[model samples]
Target: MGIKSFQGKRTTTNTKESEPILVSDYMTRNLITFKEEQPIEEVIETLIKYKISGGPVVNEKNELIGIISEGDCMKQISESRYHNLPVDKNNTVKKAMITSVETIDGNMNIFDAANKFLESKRRRFPIVENGKLVGQISQKDVLKAAMKLKSNTWK
Candidate 1:
């Protein structure tokens, strides 16, 4: 058998151009966060007004403490209706928010973010940097990134 000479490599210094896509590249920086002590109704209003499904719950220091979603609000509403009690205005975001949050670093690769989303069944995740909320990444963002990648690859 004879060895065949391979000659199909491109000699271009575009390594940076092909760098892995990161979560920060596609994450939404303009986030609507809720205060930990804010009323749940306010959180609901914010979510509805922005047309978003959920948001991060932060403290006075702008540090992410939990996450509040429409599901949480729906649960409260259902419970109140079942119990025949009027909606409680004293309910705070901290009361209904999930304390244990799954956060991702901004530098995480897009593929990793996608896998995390699939595993967690969460629609969105708060992007953290140095324990501070920097931005948010959602399933839509991942899809956009993937679409962009597909387009680029096809070209």
Candidate 2:
């Protein structure tokens, strides 16, 4: 039998009484960023190495230029295979990256972030400060924060 990896399913938490937490409270600050000029192959490798679904892409000035995800990489691979063209040096991450991204501020409440996740299909969101990427918050992180808040109330 082939081994299959299971990403945990989301279950709505009873957060009615949970206190609001900021995005920075649980966001991952150690960012794994990519350069816009980097090759798609390199991007794919980096994603795999980091075991993350997506990450922010930055310009030479360390500014967030765009974001790339596993879905985008898959689409590029599918199209390339269909076209019978190899993913060469010309195929860069910028070509496949999503330029229009929805980012959240680090100071935003976890409840707000959770609402955003429920409304959108994104698994993660980049936390920005003055238009620069600082950290990333995932749905799982929000859930964890909610659970922690719920537990703390019992103390």
What C-alpha RMSD separates each model from the true structure? 4.0, 14.6
Instruction: Give lDDT tens digits, candidate 1, residues 1-155.
Output: 87565766658865555779999999999998888788888888888888999999888777899999999988877888899987789888888999999899889999999999999999999988888899999999999999999998746
- TM-score against native, each model: 0.87, 0.83
Please state the error at residue 12 of candidate 1 in Å. Answer: 8.7
The Cα local distance difference test for each model comes to: 0.90, 0.87
lDDT of 1 at 25: 97
Winning model by TM-score = 1
lDDT, candidate 2, at 72: 94
Clashing pairs in 1: none
| lDDT by residue (tens digit), candidate 2, 63-116 | 788999999999889898899988666888889999998888888999999999
Residue 70 accuracy (lDDT) in model 2: 95
Instruction: Give the 10-residue window scoring lowest on summed lDDT in candidate 2.
Output: 2-11
- The local lDDT score (0 to 100) that residue 17 gets in candidate 2 is 62
